[model samples]
Target chain A: MRNIIVTGGSRGLGLGIAERLATDGFQVIAIARSQTEVFDAAAQRVKAAGRGALQFHAADLADIEAIPALVKAIRKEFGALYGLVNNAGLGTGGLLSGMNDAAMAQLLRLNIHSPIALTKYVTRTMMTQKGGRIVNISSIVASNGFNALSVYSATKAALVGFTKSLARELGPLEITVNAVAPGFVDTELTSGLGEAGYDKIVRRSALRRMAEVEDVGSAVAFLFSDGARNITGTVVTVDAGNTA
Target chain B: MTSRMADNTEPSVRSTILDEIHRIAALHNKQLAPLTDALPLMESGLDSLCVAVLVASLDDALELDPFAEDENLAFPVTLGDFIQLYENAAA
Candidate 1:
């Protein structure tokens, strides 16, 4: 009954990870604002696997103020969390000159600030417990820049930096903090890009296709597994050789 | 959900909060569609963090605590709903 929290678990990569973790026999507490569908899906997967219970929590990650309270609630309900997956993020795209200052600010708040706050809160609990795994869902754009993805990339880059630094800070406590930088996964976010746009992205990848959400999930699960206990402060790129 | 308070239309308090919401929402590329009532907040693409940013911006502009309690607050799905919330707080 190891407790885990997967933020943005309503769909896409987060839901994929939640489903896999549930099947692996870990009690999963999913966090999302409108995640009823995600919960139903994850529950069915868990039941089919005949392992672990699933709990869904609804919260807006954009509300940075609500994060500490949310973490506290999880601690109260589940005791001590064994793993945390900071997969909740938002995408905002526009030319730099045309983008408004407030949009940039909000993007940073959701993509960077929320994850940092959650990591800070959860790290404290993990410190006291003397064991935990943290996997941050970063973007491939963090390494390779794109035209309209400046703000989004910046936030994810900050996340990668945070992951490395926090790993150092918490490694002595036996808590591993790492990041999974996925390249163009098939999800709601990509669906919004439409067929032509998606094809362009896929062709740019070395594999000539988009990585499935579960591909990223398997990488995240590996990082959280006992075999990865010695791996920390690293960015595992599950980009299907896109960076190579 | 029209009210005498919302209709008062003074730049004093309520209007300032409404203006801030519109400004923030627009910055997020959200449509201020149907600046009237009856929009669900969760569907507007304005998540919890947007609300916090809106509150902070409102605090800076209006210098008040319109976001006093979370219990009484409703997620604003539309421009009108946000304006109504601001008006209720002002009242």
Candidate 2:
């Protein structure tokens, strides 16, 4: 059976991606810092689907040193990796000037360093087998500039560059690397926007609404399927035409 | 060649791979040096971008992955080695 790893799979977009992939029959291993109620329910649902296995590992992604061990555990259980989604990331927005050193460091660690290290470890496995799919969760801020997300945007943008370069390097094998850039989504991250902020976003968007988690999740699931076999090194915008 | 072996498919895996190489190079407007067993691919005008597309297209047609199950794989450096890489896996 093919195996996939979705980081930050306990909630929001990560959970959505995990559920869709599970429904599609790919064994999913979700790595979240904690096991929340939603995660347990989703795990049960996926297992009940009986199409594939569902497992969740609790670990802090920011602890980069723990990555190798996590990969080892995945190999022990799943044998090989068919897909990896670097969906574990932080969402922070503030003017660069106001951002403190610690916050910037933390953001970089979670947003970029951890994913790159995980990708490195997973690619080592992918190289030894049929290639796999890597979908890095990015944001519209990665492409377009935003007022308070200077550092956050920079981190997201870094993944775009990394995706393209790695896609070419791994093309000879079975693997493909791509990114899904989502605009504002109605997850807990955006829940703070409240009525007025959401109204502004809805009005400015071409689709007249914020994205749901499934919207981004579906895009990720596509990249892992044969339909997107020929797609690589490209950022698929999942935002409601906001980035369009 | 035995009749039993000939029934697998037409064009053979070897020719298929060669055709794909030429096709990819042509599609990308890359001027690969004259095909040869000893020609180094790096100097053959096949840029990194071209190689990426070539590998993906070839992988689509020929599913054999030489590097699979072995990370220490000495990746093919020449046209012959590259062809042999897939052929070895197929065998």
Best by lDDT: 2
- What is the TM-score of each predicted model, taking all chains together? 0.71, 0.73
Q: For residues A2-35, what per-residue lDDT tens digits would candidate 2 score against the true structure?
A: 8999999988889989988988899889998898
Quote the RMSD, in angstroms, for model 2. 8.5
- List residue ranges in candidate 1 displaced over 4 A: B1-91
- lDDT measured at residue A103 in model 1 versus the true structure, 0 to 100: 93
* Predicted model with the maximum TM-score: 2
Q: Is the docking of candidate 2 incorrect, acceptable, medium or high quality?
A: incorrect
User: What's the distance in Å from true for residue A27, model 1?
Assistant: 1.1
Q: How close is candidate 1 to the true structure, as a TM-score?
A: 0.71
DockQ for each numbered candidate: 0.02, 0.05
Instruction: Give the DockQ of candidate 1.
Output: 0.02
Model 2 steric clash pairs? A128-B68, A128-B69, A131-A174, A131-A175
Tell me the docking grade of candidate 1.
incorrect
Best candidate, DockQ-wise?
2
